[model samples]
Target chain A: MTTSTPLQPVVQARGLVKRYGRVTALDHADFDLMPGEILAVIGDNGAGKTTLIKALTGAITPDQGEIRLDGKPVRFTSPMQAREAGIETVYQNLALSPALSIADNMFLGREIEKTGVLGSLFRMLDRAQMRKEARAALTRLGLMTIQNIDQPVETLSGGQRQGVAIARAATFGRHVVIMDEPTAALGVKESRRVLDLILDVKKSGLPVVLISHNMPHVFEIADRIHIHRLGRRHAVVRPSDVTMSDAVAIMTGAMEPPAQAA
Target chain B: MSTDQPSSAPRGPQAFEKVLPENEAPVRFEAERESGIKRFQNLLHSHPTAIPGIVLVASLVFFSVMVGGRFLHPFNFSLIVQQVMIIGIVGIAQTLVVLTAGIDLSVGAIMVLSSMVMGRLAVEMGVPTPLAIAAGIGIAALCGFANGVLVTRFRLPPFIVTLGTWNIFFALNLWYSASETIRAQDIEASAPLLIFFGQAVELFGARLTYGSIAMLAMVAIAWYVLNRTAWGRHVHAVGDDIESARLAGIRTDRVLLMVYVVAGVICGIAAWALIGRIGSASPQAGQTANLDSITAVVIGGTSLFGGRGSIVGTLLGALIVGVFRNGLALSGVNVLWQEFAVGVLIIVAVAIDQWLRRTSR
Candidate 1:
């Protein structure tokens, strides 16, 4: 479904190369994420999905690649640099301390402090500001039933945790949000809620990169699908151009055999 | 809206009447057993580091009771308080390092070196007593700085770093003093600082020593710094999971460095408390102080794994050890038996600490 005007892509990467010892993890992969479009990266286990995300998010450095944020070349040495450059990633492990409260996890390292001697001497955290903003962010994602922002994350269910993570990623108004299997472990209802949250994120005018192996769920939400086979991005297909059967055939490599003869 | 409401009225009551939880009794019963076993398993796993403190206390109590309660007297209580003051104060510094999953084994030697710095300043260099005190603290800070840099910058394990410094300071102590004891009247005219130990407040047939108050104050400050401040949070975070804390943008190395420096400064304070109590300073003084303080810290509830513990527990541990020793001496249990008792106490305390750690998790 192409619009009258072409949307400017938020993230563009080309010829990404990564090697571990002798085995290549990602080899010459290319990807483009347009603004307001949900792009899905589908692959089997150890199919370079994790490596590609890590490289794009600057968690790991690739030997050869150019990542542009809105067409400007940039390099990130640390996750902090990537965060500042507006690339937020919510990993499968979720990286949130269970003992800490939801608000505390949201602002764990980047706490807002009052400027004064007490602030320096006592390191007084601005708890009120963080709570208010965290609540607003959760509410924007339609998670209003979670009235207690100070509750420890350990008490939350899996879907609630994912919701909090998505809220954290989008609350910063990041240019690109990468979610690793946001609904993989969730049940049907929870998965539906997560999909709706992803839609909300896209509607807020930000691009999303979703990595999952669930084809039906991917078909339900993604506008464009990229399949990785043997450490390379084999193809990018629009959901409208291909049926579920064709997509599965392409993924399983049963279709388009002997294209080398052409 | 009315059509929808009318359709749901009969069905809503029927749905409410169909109670389901009562039918799932077996599932609920299994869930209870599973959580119960999990909680029990958690309780059984304790840390080895906290055992020393408990044995110190329990044995001390057993000895005091068996020794005809000689440890319960007011005079003997004051003596025990005075005896533990130096060790307790130095233990505060040790506590800071241990909280960061690190240790400063050189604390005993640092005390000796600081005394030498003060001895040289006042006795050899002809400086005022106050200036000498400041110089002692400065020397302690510098020594701490060296320890901090070596450990943090080089990424060396703290145990090895502090062990190396312990010997270094021991050598420095002998080189500076030349095996001579710095007497009280050498430079400072007032013997009151030295005699402060003998002087006790007599109130209604009981007297309390000033050294006990100073020790208590030091404990209070240590407790506050470890529990209350932002610096304390950083210490726990760094100790708990350094990489995660760093990813959160916490300056972990700097926090570790400051912890060591603060520990060193506290050592200097302990040196003064030692000098005030004994009225003399020598290179050989505080030789066993490190072991005593470490034992006391272990007996306290603080885990060596870092990120969990309290200063109050440490102080209680110190008092327990002190009381036991004083009680044994007053009741004539012999020094040989007293040492044996202390050794046994260390083992028991460590065992309990391990148990507590397991239970908490």
Candidate 2:
């Protein structure tokens, strides 16, 4: 949680602005993520937390802003471009084909083909290899509760589906992972599992940007908290430096941000 | 403020085991212990063709009992095969589109129009039979391409797009053919190759036409493509959730376009089969084929909702229709009643689909 060391920011945004008609969604917002740190972005409803995340993930473009990844300026016009730039996002909906098998869902857009002539000529998928790899990836994440890799995703519980989405992001994400409301719909036990998953992802040495509403969950996992208020970043504080009530009060405009942290 | 525990304090396998163990084993066993009807519904959801296979067998037995041994006669069985071949072939095209949660109401029109192209090219233009056939299939593919473009680029619903195209293709068929019917005698005498499928092969005391065999072959190929290839998986993925597929970086528009184009080519092949079955290329034939092919797809256990269906199930669906018609005919049932029976089958199929979907959720 120390800011004394000069570690480079993996992803940095400045002067990010977006507007819908007269109402501004984001106004000169600034963000920073240190290497391998879990940065939790939190705010009340319509505080433009989603807008800021969307801008960063290339879901939407900001009117005026500069985003730098690894100190190099970048502009992403679409989600695909962001993905190609090594940014993976797990959406709240999970973005999975429910009727397809778990293995198929895992390999989805980036499928592996057969090695030799079969792949080149016929474009046949190596089903066995994909299944094995999918199982391995889930097991590595300690998500082996799923007994059958061939079962359709709809048959799985909410937690398992969330796990699958995270596993997908973890497998392909090279630089950074972004999760939008990862445990919003889950019960107590499921939320715990997802929290554990977020920690596991951070341990893999990839920085995670988690957008969540739960203060306790954020307090439990996040290294640093990015407080968003009134369509802009209000404060950036370490979890150890702020209590849950203070964070909530700062977000709700009940108390001013501590001068030192600001 | 109390300091929060380190995020990595509860890491690795032991932590996951503590969180996921309570309900996993119970849920699996509960699924296994469900009632017979629930299990049956589960089967229908997972393997859509199971009910169709059972229905086919049950109908065969029912017809055998109603008509005695005559229903099982080789001649009668082959007759049923011939009756189902046109719809069955077209059903392959329908199944492809349907797998992506699409419908091509113009499939029958495309088939008839393509056959007309083959007939006019061979007879009036004096083109060789093979070349004429190729022209017919090529035009069909182009028509399909147009449909795909309209659906994808214009963002039109498949139902509306195909419905409009159906009328357009039918009108084109009539205009191009000038309401002229190619005579069977001329086709047989001048271009015997066109009528080649009419030739019969005897196997195990039953007569099977090449046209019927072609239908089976198309089914097998469709099965292989849908089940074995990356493109096939893409079709399923697109049908299941287009938004998810797009997010996953699949070019959903391209997959949908390919599906439409492939469906059109298959329809053209059906056109060739149509010429072989009837010994002539008539724009008037297969008038009810559009509905018939859809009927076959639904009965075969392909979900109208898309993303979950099999081509083999479509073949069985087509056969189910054929069996019902022939069996009713043998029992001296009215023709109108036969149509009524098919209507009932469609509703039941959809009902089964809904029931199975409920269990999956």
Best by TM-score: 2
- Looking at chain B only, the TM-scores across the models are 0.82, 0.92
Cα lDDT tens digits, model 2, B285-319, are 98999999999999888889888989999999999
lDDT of 1 at B30: 58
Residue B174, candidate 1: C-alpha displacement in angstroms? 2.3
- The iRMS of the candidates, in order, is 11.4, 4.8
Worst 10 residues of 1 chain A by lDDT: A253-262
- Residue-level lDDT tens digits of model 1 in A45-128: 777878888888888888898888988898877777888898988777676655456886677666766469756766666668
Model 2 clash pairs are none
- List A-chain TM-scores for all predictions: 0.93, 0.97
Best by lDDT: 2
Model 2 scores what on Cα lDDT?
0.90
